[model samples]
Target: MRIAVPVFPGSNCDHDAYHALKHVVGVDTAFVWHKRSSLEGFDAVVIPGGFTYGDYLRCGAMAKLSPVMDAVRRFAEGGGPVIGICNGFQILLESGLLPGAMMVNESLRFVCEYVHLRAETGRTPFTGGIAPGTVLKIPVAHYQGNYFADDATLAALEERRQVVFRYCDPSGDPTAGSNPNGSARNIAGICNERGNVLGMMPHPERCSEEELGSADGRRLFDSMVAWLKEKGK
Candidate 1:
């Protein structure tokens, strides 16, 4: 599998994401520049975390207009898999590739640490290897990770089972301590209606290597690769 990791100004974690796939997962990976006009020959793409454009003009507001986003939108519409982490998730929201919006942490702080996430749905390629209700330990670092959506949109997400993951304790229970950013319903991640595109505030690549802390994130990439292979796509 080939994974495209987008690199824009201030995108410090792009290489980390690439290494997770190339070294850890042993998958073909490329660092795609944000100015690029196309995303050809890539099986999947990942928008890694970081302070894109120094988080100016809202978390991902400035990065939304980057040249690569057009290709990303096209790739997603064609049923290509795309994963957005942290700032990348914010970018997806800004790009309108995913629903809802993100706001600053309820306490207005930058949180950085390993967080527990509960798999809320089994329908997405990103979580194919993990059964529903599985617990994953991943790192989340962001100042604006609070996810919010209107009541109707939230209801629609629940109806379609698009809510893929949520902040939770080690026991997979949503609690005040497990909720990192005070997101509505403790939502940590979600997918589009088709389930090919995923946006999450947690950094899965950061924890894919056990030495980095945990291997919980590895299943996410593994599942995606396996899913693509299954379809022979």
Candidate 2:
């Protein structure tokens, strides 16, 4: 299966996503510019993180207006798997592909470091290969990674098992100290109700290899592959 990594003007993680998919994970992958209007040949889409449109106006606010997002919406509507990381997560929220909005890090500063993420569910394509409660060591870097939603919406997400990951300590306890950006309920990632679309603040590509000091993130990518392979059968 082939993967598409969308590249916005300031998307620094585009190469990182591409490298992880094509080199580390041994999957066919290609870069898709933000102007492109189609995702026809791709099996899955990964929007890498960066300051799209320089995070102008608001984080991902301008990016939601880009032409590529329309195609992404259509692709996602058709049940194509889509995963967005960090700034990409912001874009997904702004574009309405995912629920919730990003807020400034509770610390009021850009946080850049490794944190543990506990898998909250394994039903989604992105987490299917991982066991529930598995802790992944991934890095997150952003000033607005905190995620928030209305109490009703948050309740729905929890009730439907849409929450996919939560920031946690190594032992897998979601606690105040383990939350890098103070995301709601220490949430680090979540998926749409259908589980085809996911947005998260962590940068899995940054830790997909042992050389990067962790391979835990690779399980996420590998999980997507496993899901696709199963469907293709």
Candidate 3:
């Protein structure tokens, strides 16, 4: 199956994502420019991390208005699997493709390090191969990574099992100390109600290979590939 990796002006992880999916994951992948208007030939899309618009206008505020976002929105609405990483997640939030908003880190500092993520659910296209409570080692690099949601939305996410990944200790416990950004509910990743769109702060593409100290992130992409392949059949 073919997948698309959209590239914004300041996107630094587009190549990383392309490498992870093409060379590592062995999937046919392409880069969709920010000005592109259609996702006509793609099966899925991955919005990689970076300082979109130099992180001006509040992270993704200005980037959300990019022409490509409309296509991304249309693709998501059509049930296409979409994954947003770091700043890309911020863009999705701004585009209303996902719920919640991000704030500065609790430490009031940029966080850049590998952290453990516990899979909270496996029902989504991005986590179908992971069992609940499975801990994965992935790196996260961002300043505004703290995820915040209203109590009602939080409750609904939990009840619907849309909370896919959570920050946790290596032992798989979601402890307060393990929360790097101090996000509400320790949420590191989540899916929309349809389970096709996923957004997370971790840089999965950077850690998808074993030489990078961890290959756990590959499993996330693998899950999406498997789901798309199965759906095609």
> How badly does each model clash, as a count of residue pairs?
0, 0, 0
In model 3, pairs of residues that clash are none
Local accuracy of candidate 2 as per-residue lDDT tens digits, 60-124: 99888878899999999999999999999999999999899999999999999999999999989
| C-alpha local distance difference test of each model | 0.92, 0.92, 0.93
- Per-prediction TM-score, please? 0.98, 0.98, 0.98
lDDT accuracy of residue 11 in candidate 3:
95
Model 3 clashing-pair count: 0
Clashes of 2: 0
Kindly provide the TM-score of model 3 when superposed on the true structure, using C-alpha atoms: 0.98
Q: What tens-digit string does per-residue lDDT give for candidate 1 at 101-123?
A: 99889989999999999998878
Q: After aligning candidate 3 to the native by TM-score, how far in Å is the CA of 156 from where it should be?
A: 1.4
| Alpha carbon lDDT at 25, candidate 1 | 90
Answer with 2 or 3, whichever has the higher lDDT: 3
Per lDDT, the best of the predicted structures is: 3
Choose 1 or 3, whichever is better by lDDT.
Answer: 3
lDDT of 3 by residue, 29-119 (tens): 9999999989998999999999989988788998899999999999999999999999989999989899999999999999999999999
At residue 152, candidate 2 shows an lDDT of 97
